[model samples]
Target: MKIKSYFQFTNEQRRGVLSLLLLIVIIQLSYFYWSSSKSTSPSNSNKSWLAMQSVIDSLKISQSSSEGKIYPFNPNFITDYKGYQLGMSLTEINKLFEFRKQNKYVNSALEFQQVTGVSDSLLLAISPYFKFPDWVNQPKKAFSSFDKNTYENKKSIIRKDINEATQDDLIKIYGIGPALSERILKQKDVLGGFVTMEQMESIWGLSPEVIENLNKYFQVTTIPTVNKIDINNLSVKELAKFPYFNYTIAKEIVTYRSMNNGIHSIEDLTKIKGMPNEKIKIIALYLEF
Candidate 1:
């Protein structure tokens, strides 16, 4: 009986120890699941804190580069963007200026690439602010009746010869700005005179628009003959040949004709603002309109 009781006590003790071990394992598993669930909950603030840190890092980089200004980024960062390149060259930059003058704002870097098959680095440098003005994208405004007729009247009076165009003849070309007109005159002197319309392109400041506009007015004819006795077309050298006409009077007459177009009739001679009537009549007999 004593041996059987001892064996039963040993069996009970083993069962009790096994039950306690199972309970401890169950509690450990439950605690682990609860901790995992808390970590994965959407209400966890750590994720937001990590995102904020990333944004702060990006802002720090931007501020350091820009000296704290928030202006748009410079185009030099094209290298950082995948598949983009600093593909333009110095020669391409010169071509962009030429293209811009001809097309105004119609051309962009993409269009330039299409036209020249090369990119422009200077244009890329300025591309961040590149934009066409509203007027360029919109249809052109029509000229008023007075403006149209005034241009027509002026066109009828102006005469041009590509071989012998004076500064005044160049000014008459539409779209030839004052600066460009002066450039043409300077080029004419430098080249010893223009032999062809293409020569105008050699001028450093001559825009393509000026060349196009002036081309319409160009004539490649023999130089016109000027009679020494005709005051209308006579140069200072020819006028000085007259016995009584001094260099001053010759220059004055040429200046007057330039301002008012050539004196239309002998009676118009007296209309020169400063010429005395007696002197006009003397010159009138020798002058032809």
Candidate 2:
């Protein structure tokens, strides 16, 4: 009986010991799992930091390449370097805005130069940065042909017939001002059309040089026949038929011719009190004695 009891007590103690061992093994496994989970959490954090660092490095590289591409040929960048040397004051530089408005680049820098006398080297420095618009170099070719045609037509009219020519035709010729055109029309009304090129010089205020310049562009082919009248017998109305001889001048001419017993020669015209040698010379080409 004693032996059985001792064996029973030993069996019970062994079972208790096995239970404590099992508890200790479970505690160790839990500790290992917790420690491995803590270690893996730190490793995940480290990997995340590495990934973030890679992303930041990629962004830095991209920024560097972008800056490299835009460094050259930037107009603003070029202007910044050149504007300092241009010597343009704030007010003068402001004038560029006005010039930009009208698109007039030819006179853009002229006013600035007048004010500051900016050096030529400085002007050259800024010249490249200031882009003259493409249209300035490529002016409208639309008027080119029209201008050429007008120039040719003007030359043709000056050398052509004058009696049949209209006012439009007369204006095309050189040396014909508005006053001269009126004078020509008045002379045509009094003595018909021009019979000789020399008659143009007889117009009021016309100089000899003007007549000489115009002679190259004109010619005379026809002369109108004037009825031979005895100057002494001529009435004021008949004497007024002469070109530039107004009613007052006609009365004077008729009175003088009557007093002088009818003018017969070109020298007789000079004998009249009001008729000067210069005046007779101008009218001689149109008159028939």
Candidate 3:
């Protein structure tokens, strides 16, 4: 009888099992419905994200455009940030830096392009905004017209001796004026008179062209009488008074003279370390052993 009972199902137990199965089915159905309704579709989600991205992109474009507004500026003075805003490359900016380092400048838009090697289209874009100094835009003064006959007569004029040239004569050279003429005469007076044409180089303001003209017009036909200084016997202080010998060279000479019993010639002076070998010939003109 107990074995038979083990196989038998009570009505209450069967009903309980059926009720539990029904409850599980209801819960599963509710979960499926809730999941389908609560979650969004893939298409809708992508659409929403794309719309937000477009708004973000538009805002960025507007901000960049507003901030990048250009004003009138000198192209010569572009800083790194300013250059970036002007659409300049790193290479181009560095080229400008190298030009400025040499103490040179770009005076015109075309010159700026040549120095920086910017593109023509870019130059055209930026050139309208470039504001250079007033002097740069002004037309250069034209040379005055000379009468052909007068010009021919002037060219035929004979060159004169420079040694005897007066200040009025000196000013007739292309570059010389009142001030330069005065300086030349003063230097000549200091030297007791010009000896060799090479001595004209010491004149402070005479350009090579002016010197050439002076040489063309003048010759040291008569060597000036210079009172030669006794280099061996003069005190260091007195020796320093010579135009070519500064106090430092004078002291060095005195020190070497003391060590070697006295400097005898140009060779001895050359061996004194600080004596200028190249200028020895000129220095010898005013010095005596």
- Which digits, one per residue and each the tens of the lDDT, describe model 3 over residues 3-100? 99986889998999899999999999999998887665446777899789989999999998888577999888899888988899999999999998
Each candidate structure's TM-score, on Cα atoms with residue i matched to residue i, is: 0.28, 0.36, 0.46
Top model number, TM-score: 3
lDDT of 3: 0.81
Could you say which candidate leads in lDDT? 3
Give, for candidate 2, the lowest lDDT window spanning 10 residues.
Answer: 68-77
For candidate 1, the 10 contiguous residues with the lowest summed lDDT are 74-83
Clashes of 1: 0
lDDT of each: 0.59, 0.59, 0.81
How many residue pairs in model 2 have overlapping backbones? 0
- For 102-157, candidate 2 gives per-residue lDDT tens digits of 63334233443543355677656554444432222333335445587788876775
> Is 1 or 3 the stronger prediction by lDDT?
3
Q: Which sections of candidate 2 miss by over 4 Å?
A: 1-158, 174-182, 204-213, 226-230, 237-241, 246-252, 279-289
Of 2 and 3, the candidate ahead on TM-score is 3
Clashes of each: 0, 0, 1
Error of 3 at 243 (Å): 2.0
TM-score of 2: 0.36
Off by over 4 Å in 1: 1-125, 128-157, 162-172, 201-209, 218-289
